[model samples]
Target: MGMIGKYARLTPGELQQILGDPALGHRLVEAMGEDEEDGRRLDVDKAWHAMSFFLDRLGFPVEVVFGEQEVAGAPDWGYGPPRYLPPAQVRVAAEGLARIDGATLTGAASRQELFEAGIYPDSIWTRDEDALAYVWAHYDSLVAFMTTAALAGDAVVTWIS
Candidate 1:
């Protein structure tokens, strides 16, 4: 199986509950599996690496891509424990992401540039043209996800699984 980037929107109450007991983070993410209809969840698939690299190169803060708050004791199935951003931070991230025009993101870097920059899943960078297209599509989805979370004043949890 491949690593997938996942995000879950948390209401203030849910955020508090998880913060008060870090273990709740695991339960929350696991429960998300059973509720696939929830609009609060997003899966960016394997595009996370290229997206993060592009966002970082574009001057967006790391918090927007990887989050700032680490949920201590949360299980790390692969990459690491789930990380979170508070509602205020989510709004900030959403604003930053909104400023990234499609033309700019798509034209900012070539596959070789990205590969040399050390974007993850290194093999994809030299494989085919579809790699960048795949990253761009997932990035659009991520922007939409963050925008909705920000509008709802919801916290966001992100992890690799």
Candidate 2:
């Protein structure tokens, strides 16, 4: 057993069970270095890799949720105002959101700016709907990746949104 594997731990019957797909299971198994008696081998890097894998399988959506004009096009989902915006809570909420593999913007702005040449939010924690507009304007690839990890068996993304 490798040192990492020995130190790592697993709580599920099999990594495949959590991933909900056989192909993902195969990938995780291959990613693992070796078996360990402690069985505690979960880590962020592995989870991130899995998220990227699943996003690749899902295929990111072409639409941007925040676009109000004809140029931005439609998306699979819509964005709206959140109930509240607190301090130090900007990182995840301000970044972006993706149900599967697309981006969404919920505030006053359209979804076009996130990927547009000069489109990015001044900050995520801003209470101004206009300032928060960027979150809706662009599809969050990172969120899509993280969501996949959270959906995976026994895995959770506690940090950021």
Candidate 3:
């Protein structure tokens, strides 16, 4: 409900057209991108930050490729201040994220790791069983988006609503 985001893998030129004509941008977003509409109601930025925390815990440094601020204009997608990661960069981050073991991402250990990072409140984090479910939901959702982008040689992109 607060600052939600959807992602799409798009070519630079196709993206250019979307940003160039605001009238058709919203339509394009629906058709061209994947929406995390069914997942837990977590802010995209917070989820991304948590992912960053997870990466750091493993002694790996990767770029936060989502919800960034870039100097670009949106066409039909509405206002400006959108950011996008090129296909090459998306592929790189996708690889890093994909490196996380499936079990590690959904297991108790990963939940504890995130809790230790102070990303969630102590009260809620104490409920590891519940917390882990939500955590895994977001993790899987992100992986799906990033992996899709990487496979299609498309950029990872988002715009402010």
Alpha-carbon shift of residue 50 in model 3 (angstroms): 2.3
Candidate 1 wrong stretches, greater than 4 Å = 34-37
For model 3, residues 44-117, the per-residue Cα lDDT tens digits are 43354455555555655444434443525445243354566777777887787787764564444655666676
What's the distance in Å from true for residue 110, model 1?
Answer: 1.1
Ranking by lDDT: 1, 3, 2
For model 1, residues 76-132, the per-residue Cα lDDT tens digits are: 746888899999999999998888865567665788987897777777889978888
CA lDDT of every candidate: 0.82, 0.27, 0.56
Model 2 stretches astray by more than 4 angstroms: 1-104, 110-139
Among all windows of ten consecutive residues in candidate 1, which has the lowest summed lDDT?
Answer: 29-38
Deviation of model 3 at 55, angstroms: 2.7
Models ranked on TM-score: 1, 3, 2
Query: What's the lDDT of the predicted structure labeled candidate 2?
Result: 0.27
Residue 59 in candidate 3, Cα distance off native in Å: 5.1
Query: What are the runs in model 3 whose C-alpha is more than 4 Å off?
Result: 18-27, 30-46, 59-61, 64-80, 102-128, 159-161
Please name the candidate that would achieve the greatest TM-score relative to the true structure: 1
* lDDT for each residue of candidate 2 in 1-161, tens digit (9 for 90 to 100): 11110112122444224234433432343365444222323223212222322333344331111111121121211122111111112123323333332322232233243224232222223334443323222234334433333343222211111
Give the Cα error of residue 115 in candidate 1, in Å: 1.9
